[model samples]
Target chain A: MLKGHQTWVFASKPVIRSASAIGGPFEAKGPIAEDFDTLHSDLMIGQDSWEKAERTLLEEACDKAIEKAGLTKETINFFLSGDLMNQIVSSSFGARTLTIPFLGLFGACSTSMEGLALAALMVDSQSAEYVLAATCSHNASAEKQYRYPTEYGSQKPPTAQWTATASGAAVVSANGEGLRVTSATIGRVVDMGLKDPFNMGGAMAPAALNTIEAHFRDRQLPYDYYDLVVTGDLGRVGHSILSELLPKHQIEIPLDRYQDCGIILYGDNPDVWSGASGCGCSAAVTYGHLLRKMKEGTWKKILVVATGALLSPLSYQQGESIPCIAHAVSIETE
Target chain B: MLKGHQTWVFASKPVIRSASAIGGPFEAKGPIAEDFDTLHSDLMIGQDSWEKAERTLLEEACDKAIEKAGLTKETINFFLSGDLMNQIVSSSFGARTLTIPFLGLFGACSTSMEGLALAALMVDSQSAEYVLAATCSHNASAEKQYRYPTEYGSQKPPTAQWTATASGAAVVSANGEGLRVTSATIGRVVDMGLKDPFNMGGAMAPAALNTIEAHFRDRQLPYDYYDLVVTGDLGRVGHSILSELLPKHQIEIPLDRYQDCGIILYGDNPDVWSGASGCGCSAAVTYGHLLRKMKEGTWKKILVVATGALLSPLSYQQGESIPCIAHAVSIETE
Candidate 1:
């Protein structure tokens, strides 16, 4: 049912039966490398192009999730996916291989939660017995499309983030023994008139804050109700901004319990500059690390807010500011 | 409830309370010009860039839809939208202006029905009281990104389809006095190994047929159940191909009631080559022309299948075959 303005409280509480995360060479060396289901030693992952490699990652994640769920692809009623590519080709191509009824989404980095929220809704509403939510991103592919080609070795400001080469998939089922998706808060586009694409985290911080505030307000829950709250890819810059902004809004998320996927993904890897930021950064970290942690009894309930900067290369070139959004999914173990 | 593997039977039957179609100069010259709420004499639509113009069209359509629904933007719970631009900037920017909780989608030309289906589902499931589904495309914007730039004035083959410059928006509500959305069939990606980006219609025809067949089979409805069956933008080439393919699959949509938005939009305009094709073509025609006809008692039931060629310019450049998808929504007047 609708809560407050934008939140949906899933009365049926759809379960996430299983999840998988696939990563490339760089992610294989990350702090949470062990959390991934599959980590390729090569970025290309046997594909001829970066885009193809990204698609492969997504396909593998979906297959692994389904297998772990003890289900076949044919049993899944729908596949909702997206990626950080021109026209979201990775998700489309990945869906082509999965051959499940597909719904293509595009929320930039926030696609993971967007897909998951919709998937849970489908299951909760009895529209589907099983639904797959998946998303992927490739560093090289994103760089080539969004900015300078990697071959150019373009210099970047410290505010710039490294796009994670990873993929994540989760299976939401009407009946399952796993973590339940209890609620979700869909985000409104928020633009603070920041035009620097390199500083995406900074651009998206307000959106993350807006969604988080909306989530708590709509759910009518205390800020501390969840053991932890994670922002998808706010990184250090956006994370800091959000931290400063929260208190001003009279929202008090415990510092110890609040974290960001971008900041934690690489764990102080200097090469990443601001932090990891991409569709896959949040997807891989949440589906793999956070969910695993929850299952391991580290936390009972958590809210993941996946953030996205809604700016295309053309938009930036045309002097348009980055419009950002975030989607928050509340997952709980009972 | 799930009717079949891929079809959703909305027990609540969400109503399309109001819809608006906005078109550019070329569409103003089309047969359905009178159906549109607003038509701009300039392709730019008072914007400096084609992308911005496309965003303006979407915004106008959305505003018109909400106003016609006798509601304000604040009363709408969600806005689901997509466009042909890279990362779907048009929808994102439009969402920024509308400031509604947004869900971004990407189905190439099929985005219209994809958004509508999801919007209906949200309302049918009682997740939202009101949801806006909208999409748009611009001839110049699509051409610059997918094919040659408008300034190039490049020669095109007969199989090439003209991209429509238009936008359409529909407000789906839990309770309204209008056409009801009874069912929706989500589509799987289908590839026939066609790699030519110029011939999107040819590539997408199979997908359109695939979804139409699924919709009928899953709903257990007869071929002639609806008063009309309209494909999004198959153009003449893809339309003919689909007509022949339907018989092969034993799916018989009556020829008298069958139509294509692309073929009918321009009404034998030779400059359009094969016909009009874009995200907006089906959207404008369906929301504006077809719905108006239905309200005028031209028909009681109709099925709209929006077809999309999910191929990026980069994908085609990399020699990847175009993947296509189609979504079918059943609209019935009580």
Candidate 2:
């Protein structure tokens, strides 16, 4: 049901029956490498192209999640997916492989939470018995499309965040025992006229703050209502900016409970200038690391705000400012 | 609420309170030009670039629809949109301008009905009071990204379809007196391993057929239940293919009621090789021409099956086949 302005309060609390994360070689060296259900030593995962490798990651995540849920591809009612690919071909091809009724989405990196929110809504409304929500991104694939080809050995600026090659998928069931999706806050597009694609973290920070503030206001929850509040791939720059902006807006949360997927993905890695990013960063960390912690009773309730810098290479080339958005979904265990 | 596999029957029937379509100069010369709410004499619509022009078309259509519904942008609860552009910049930028809470979808050309179906579901479930569903495409922009640049004047095959420069928007509300959305059948990704991007209609025909058959089967409705069964943009080639394939599956929709938006857009224009296409083709025809006729009581019920070819230039260049999808929504008037 509609709660306030942009939030949906799911009365039935659609349960996250199972989740799986798949990663590439780069992610296997990261701090939370063990959290992923499967990690490929080869970035290609035996695929010919980087794009195909990205699609393979999504397929593996989805298949693993479905298997973990004790369900087959035929049992799922719908598959909601998207990726940081032109025309979202990875998701479309993955959908073809899965053969589930599919809904393709495009929210850049925020696609992870966007799919989850809509999937939870479908289950809560009795529209489906089971729905699969998934998203992915690949470093080489994204680099080739948005910047330069991986073979170029391009030197990125300090503000540039490394795109993580990863994919995550979750199965939401109408009847299950697991972490439940309690509510969701859809985001409004926010642009501060920032045009730096390399500094996506800075460009997206405002949108992240906007949705987080809206989520609290609409849900009418206290600042400490969530045991943990994590953002999707905001990197170090955006994370610091949000931490600073929150207090200015009179919003207060303990620093210990405030974390970011981008910052956590590759802790202190020198190669990643700012931090890690991409649709897969938040997805892999959340579904893999965070969800595992929640299942182990490390936290009972948490909020995952997936942020996206909605800019194509062409948009920035055309001298347009970066438009950003964030979608927040609250997950809790009884 | 769940009718059968892949179908949802809305019990509270969400109403299409208002709809508006905008078009470029080429579309202004079409047979149904007068049906459009606004037709720009210049393809640019005074914008400097084709992408911005596409965004402008979406903005105009949304504004017109909201005005027709006597509602302000602030009154609308959410905006669901998508486009054919890379990263769907048109919808993202349009959402930025509107400042509405947004959900960005990527269904290639099927975005129109995909947005409509999601919007109707939100309204029918009381998750939103008023939701705006919109999509757009610019011919030049799509040509530049997907094929050759428009300025290249490259010789295209006779099988190629013209990408339309158009946009369409509709307002779906929880309570209204207008055409009601009764049911929706979400489509699965259907790839027949068709590799010719030039002949998209041929590649997408199977998807359109699959969804149409699923719609009839899941809704437990006869093929002739609808006064009209209009397809998105199968064009001349795919239209004939579908016509021949239908009877083989024991599905018999009346010939008079079966139509394609691609075939109707240009009438007998030789310049349009096969017919019109893009995310905007079906959108403009259905929201402008079809809805107008229904309002005038010329038809009581219709099915709009928006089809899409989910392939990118990279995918085709990598020798991957085109994956296709179609989403169908049932609109009726009492």
Candidate 3:
């Protein structure tokens, strides 16, 4: 049902039957490495190119997710997946192997929850018995498309956050025993005249705050409704901005419970600059670290707000402000 | 109810309340010029950059859609949109102006029906009172990202198609006075080792056939069920391939009623090469021309299958095969 303004309250909540995460060497050495199912020692992962490596990572994640759910690819009625790559080839190539009816999404970094929301909706509406939601990002692949290639070794700005070379997948279904998606808040694009693509956190912060505000207002829920409120990849900069802006908006949540996947992934590593950010940042963190905490009963309910900076190299070079959006989905273990 | 293996039977039968189409000068002279709501005299639309021109096109289409429906932006619950642009910045930036909750999608040329299917599903599920589906493409923007800058004027193969400088949008509601979406068939990614990005139609033809076959098989319907069966932008090459392959797979439909938007948008112009191809190609054709025909009773029921070539400049440079998918939606007059 439609909630207050922008939220959809899932009447028949969809459950996550199983989920799996995969990461490359850089992410493998990060703080949350133990949470992922598999971590490769190298970026290439035996693949010739970074793009192929990304596809291979996605394939393995999907396969592992299905296996963990005690099912096969045939059981999945549809697969909703996306990535940061141009035209989203990694997810599409991965879909070729899975052979499931596919729907490709592009919300930039917000694709993880975007896919999850759609998959949950399908299961909740009985349109699909089982749906797979997945997303991936490769640092090398992203660098080549968005900026100079890694081989070019251009000087990097400290404001630039590292794109995680990882992938995560989840099997969403009805009557499954795991965390259930109770509600979803789709976001409106918000541009704040921030033109710097290197500082994506600055570009995406307002969008994150906007969605979080809408979620709370539309649901008419106080801050205590969840144990945590985690943002996708706002990194340190955007996290601080959100923290400052929330109270200004008269919305208050415990400071300690407010975490960001970008900040958590690298565990305060200076090499990550502003911190980790990408489609895989939230995906690997949510499906891996968050799920682990939920299974351990450390958290019963939480809100995941995934932010996306919607810009291209052309758009940025053409002097366009970065438009951003953030989708929020509430997950509860019951 | 769940119909077959991959089809979703929309029980609520969402209706298309209103739609709008915008075309640049090139498309304004096309075969279906009369169908579009607005036709600009220039590709730039008086904007400084082609990217901004693309964004302006989307905004106008969306605004016209809502206005034609006798509603405002606030009445729309969600907006699902995409384009050929990398990261879909046009749709995203357009969303900022519309201020509607948005979900960005990517299926290349297949985006129109993919968006329609998602919008219909949302309305049918009662998740939203109204949803808007839209897509756009500019030849200049596409060329700059996919191949060469338009100013470069690189030589192209005859098999290549022209990207339309156009945008199309439709408003979907639970109850409205228009054609209703009865069912949708999501497609599978089918890669046939075709590495040529220039020949997208050839790369996409098999994927289109695969979905059309599944749609027919899943619905247990024959050729006579739909008065017209159209594939998105398979162009001339893909159209011929599909026509030949259908009979081999024991599928037979009237060739006259079977058409491709790629062929229909332009009046067989030699400069268009194979035909018109873009996210806008199928969208403007289906939402504008075909819908007008439906209203005029030229055709009562139809199946629109939108095909997408999922590839990237990086993918092609790295020597990866083109992966493609097609999504089909059935519209009917009751």
Candidate 4:
């Protein structure tokens, strides 16, 4: 019984509806996925409610996860999840359906890892037999909140992570039937006091570098100990910064071997400017690709490092600079 | 040994800053307890980068947590934490100083729990005997992103949670001489599909009610089994609704025995209008008050139930209703 299984990534499947992908107050509607054209026009004026849109998405994902895991709603212990809403509408609204307990979390994009880590603890402590950790991101809403809306046609900086147009979820248990949170290394905040929220990719690079280095050192493992070291939505600028930072420290992790959400979401598409960021970035990547690899034994040991930029508009207005952080955990399947 | 720790709250602490303490943003900007009317006017229009602010807060808090936990920058295994920023600035930026492995999380306000849960997993799995968990919240930033900004002056319904103008943090370790994550119950979302983002107090009421009810049932523990059944930030309206709903379900838990962040922050002051709700609401209560009680042996078993109303202003604008969820985890001081 893997106590709780959850994942975070950019997109489970390629997003077809670009309009629905975007979300946020100024988006004029939920992501184009929620039928933005007809659903509501207030999303344009920043008066729309994203909580409901997230709720519907979360509910669908949860239902699918439970069904795939072959568990009834009653058997599950609680709904532990969260999102970018003021009160975390995604998890909370979805949680209203189950008769079980629920927990809503907010760690930004790193939420999936946090949920998985917690689920691992529950199982390790024998506190519960199973749990769920999940997160999501809507392109339009996120764009409006972070940058300009589609109407604005703002140019994204190379360091800026494209808000992933997706959502990802996972189920962890103690049964050992799936991947296990073999080892989790907590990452502390490391602030060089870098400003520029738009360039979060650059700000978070050092944190990511530090975490990956620490994870390898702490475990007494080499860089190649894992098949891949993944970073969440570092975009082009941050990716290069991390690459250079690692080599400068005499740590040479293969650039190709290490993946990022920012680069992965687009693959070769022109729609996504720099790359994907937000919770969906990590959520979709982990759930859609990494887990599949784990199950197929294509990869044995993997390090999923999800990074987040914890800035708010107010902080920006206060003339405060930007700070970055990252969390790294190793997962392996038997 | 405790791996890491960090803490941060509003620079200004207000005396009447309760759930019902209604006031405009910047109304209590400067040190409220000692100084007032010296509001920081520059924070009016978004200026500085949010990334910088997040980085600063994370660094400050991590320094304190690490100092208190007696962990050095080098020996720390990893950094794990989250926040409300789109990219999880708190953990990412904070990770820079520690120079450790990082994992960012997003569980909304449940992020503190998410961090703790992950820390516990790392420790218990024998992968790491030391780890840390930290979380933070900013009232102005959170409000503007999730709800209307103080400038919006939107009339909040009775059920709306009062966003706390504060932040709190903690460190969880395998060797810390403090309370451990003895037993935790993971939650699964059960959406009642309740709409109405503004009235999350009502939307989330069912989820909280169900989770509390189920926690008792799943563990076969009576309502009286714990010292107090606390909800994060259910304001007056939601608290009343929950109180009524619990009894209606024939689960007569003492209303007085239960606590709400909204109510606790404001004793009798009605200025706030609604009760308290925010990442900081339950955070301060748990880390500041509840932790003290646990240490003093005044309270033994605590079922800390954090509630989140999953609604985004953009979602509401999409003409979508709000959804609510809650997570219940029992904390006992052994």
TM-score of chain A of 4: 0.81
Q: Could you give candidate 4's per-residue lDDT for residues A114-222 as a string of tens digits? A: 6665555544544445565667666665665656667977776545555754566666666646666766554555556777877788878887886677667656677
lDDT of 1 by residue, A71-135 (tens): 99998999999998988999999999999999999999999999999999999888999999999
DockQ score, prediction 3: 0.68
lDDT pick, better of 2 and 4: 2
Give a tens-digit lDDT track for model 2, residues A181-293.
99999999999999989899998989989999999999888998999999998899899989998889987877678899999999989899899999999999999999999
Instruction: For residues B1-334, write the lDDT of model 2, one tens digit per residue.
Output: 3423998889999999999999999999999999999999998899998888999999999999999999999999999999999999999999999999999999989999999999999998889999999999999888888888777789988889999999999999988789999999999999999999999999999999999999998888988899999999999988988898888889899878889999988877989998999999999999999999999998899999999999999899999999999999999996
Candidate 1 is graded, for docking, as medium
Compose the digit string of candidate 3's lDDT tens values, residues B117-179: 999999998888899999999988888778887777788898899998899999999986888
The residue pairs in collision within model 2 are none
- lDDT of candidate 4 over B109-218, digit per residue (tens): 55555555455555554444455556656655666566665686878665555565444555555454665454344444444666665566666677677767766765
lDDT of 3 by residue, A1-334 (tens): 4523778888888899999999999988888899999999988989998889889999999999999999888888999999988888888889999999999999999999999999989888888999999999999888888999677778778889999998999999897689999998999999999998889998898999899989998999988788999999999988998899888988888878899999999988999899999899999999999999999999999999999999888778877789999999999987
Q: Number of clashes in model 2?
A: 0
Better of 2 and 3 by TM-score: 2
Ranking by DockQ: 1, 2, 3, 4
* Model 1: CA > 4 A from native: A1-4, B1-4
- Compute DockQ for each candidate against the true complex: 0.72, 0.70, 0.68, 0.26
User: How does residue B3 of candidate 4 score in lDDT?
Assistant: 10
